[model samples]
Target: MINPLGIVITVLYYKIAEKIKKISIFSKIPPIVIAGVMLIATLEIFDIDYDIYNESAKYLTIILIPATIALGYPIYKNIELLKKNKRIIYTGFIIAAVIAILTTYVVAKMCNTEFIVIESMLPKSVTAPMAVEISKGIGAIPELTACIVALTGIFGGVFGHKILKLIKVKSDVAIGLSIGAASHVIGTARCIEEKRESQVVMASVALVIVGIITAIIIPLFIYLIK
Candidate 1:
């Protein structure tokens, strides 16, 4: 039942991907993305069932609970930042959630995208765990929601800073919120890569607030539109 080899392979894939991530051209690509791709390739080559892999590696998912709680550290360190700009920060999260959902919905409708896809993508900007639950609650495909969320995060993490700089927006809070609201934890991880504690702290908070805000509105919006 406990397949140690699956655990070893999973960790090894991620470790190798992390090393690959150090390359300048590959720097923007997150290790998880690379590791996930490689793992999929390996599984297909070996004809391994995903169930076997997931059963062994499910323990890793538990670590996310503590990792999420640890984000409170940055918030504690930067509590003053929130205290000083609670209005702006809260407003930003709300605006970001509303815009992300509205735009996705409108565009998908215009494009005649599938109902299932639109529902799944409605929460694409949210973090995986919350996004998955939202997808289910809204009667969407959780698997598709997870994939779209990952891609959205990757896109935001890779280009968020570059796009901000291109526009001459240098404020860490703005940058963090933009990336975090758009991409969730992966974009926040990009903030970590930049070593800007200001960015990281704000980003971590952005995803949480934005996630909550999105979760509340999306189901209501779906019900209204459908």
Candidate 2:
């Protein structure tokens, strides 16, 4: 027979994590669920700090990359749709790139946020790992950038359709580009679910283009302003 204490601990921890993950409040927000589990576990356990877990978490995250790569299979399978609308898709990507960078820079500046904060915020629409690296390259806080990126993705995924509808966006290509431009990876996931071929392409383009743009623009702005 197994030890009851071990089983009880395992069940309790899993139950807590599952409850948080399944709840409507947390279901749509992956970053929050991930963070919540770590927070709760740390608080309930002995002598475990975020720093300690963070050092170890890098190893855990390596396994997650392959899972993310699996998401690309659907996009590859839908290449016919992507090819048919190449013109509209490319135009949408270009426009989306311009809007994402400019709006983020303008809003952060208008809010009187710090230059580094603004720099970090500019890449908040990119995938978290990429955003963190971009923030570091531009002399911003990686942790802050990661948090903002996660929040931006969650907001974009949850409300992208509403915003698109409100703005009367009619083209599927345009809609796809908008989601990719504003939401990054999470938005890409939503696009995949909708079978939006244009979006998948634009999202891939947006991730690369916007990342490159932010890496250039934010640093240049800091130098010019100072």
Candidate 3:
């Protein structure tokens, strides 16, 4: 039987984390990161195996599919904007994907990373499911790929706005595309917080586009290089 206790504990932690995020000092920190840290510490203190926690928490992961589909509402509401800028959106997505892949490969090579590590890191910019699949196809570790994907999302969620400001990225479309392409759902969440409908729409669109492109291109590229 599935442990109902685990689900209860997980939901409680998330609720507490959300409240904590509303505090002035913790406002900037993403709730997922906070909850993750809290969960890790709690597990360590109790000497709980991560695999056991994962098994207990599997239902939450399943909810993510429907949650992702729900993001379409914002995009659908802003359909006209997306249609108006389809060309630019597609162009920017392609460019961002290319740069992301090349930079990951180049940095891994420069650091003298192992072949498997390079392959795993190559899909770090996309969503976790796609990243894991791409990593598996390229003979990389799916677990490692998932880790990199999560880190990318967290880092982008936390610091993406500051980076964009530093680079003087003024366009909403550009901001949305860059964050979504680089950080996936976490970045899209950040974009939604901006309280701008257009940005949310563009971010959602960019995320879907980038995920699709990464899923299609990375495997082919790996095959060619091998």
Candidate 4:
């Protein structure tokens, strides 16, 4: 049977983490990251089995499905913007997918990292699920891919807007696509926090489309290089 105790503990930890995020130094850090770190420490300190804790905590991932669908509201509200910029937006998605994959590959190769590690890192820009499947096909470690994806999301969510501002990027859609393409749902969630409807809409769209584009491109990229 599922353990409500795990759910209760996880939720409790998450709420506290959210409050902690209000601190100046921590304001840029994600609540999930804070909560996750604390939870891991608690588990280690107590010698608790992670699988037991995950019994109820796994259900929370189920909530993500509906949460993702709800993001469509912003997209619907901003339909005209998408319609007007369909051509540019479509082209941007392809570019976003290609650049993310290529940069990771090129940099990893340049650093002379192990090929398996590089493969695992390749799908880091996409969301977790897509990254896992892509990892399987490409000889990447799913566990490492998941970690990379999370870290990628955190980096983009924390630094993306600031970098955009520094570069004088003023367009909401451009910022949204850039974040979403690089960080997936986590970056999109950041847009929602800022309450920018245009960014939210474009980011919501960008994460999904960019994942699709990345999935399609990876195979072809592997084949061409081989």
TM-score for each candidate, following the candidate numbering? 0.84, 0.69, 0.82, 0.78
User: Model 2 over residues 37-130: C-alpha lDDT tens digits?
Assistant: 5655654677655555555455544554575456456557655655776776556555665577778888878889887778778778777766
Give the poorly placed runs of model 2, Cα more than 4 Å off.
1-26, 31-33, 40-49, 58-91, 195-201
lDDT of each residue in 81-184, candidate 1, tens digit only? 77878898889989999999999999999999999999999998988878877888888998789788989999998788999999999999999988999999
Overall local distance difference test of candidate 4? 0.85
Residue pairs that clash (backbone atoms under 3 angstroms), model 3:
none
Q: List lDDT for all candidates, in order.
A: 0.87, 0.67, 0.82, 0.85
Candidate 3 shows a clash count of 0
Whole-model lDDT for model 3 versus the true structure? 0.82
* Predicted structure 2: lDDT: 0.67
**lDDT: which is higher, 1 or 4?**
1
Worst 10 residues of 2 by lDDT: 1-10
- What's the C-alpha lDDT at position 42 in model 1? 91
Overall local distance difference test of candidate 1? 0.87
Candidates sorted by TM-score, best first: 1, 3, 4, 2
- Overlapping backbone residue pairs in candidate 1 total 0
Top TM-score hit: 1
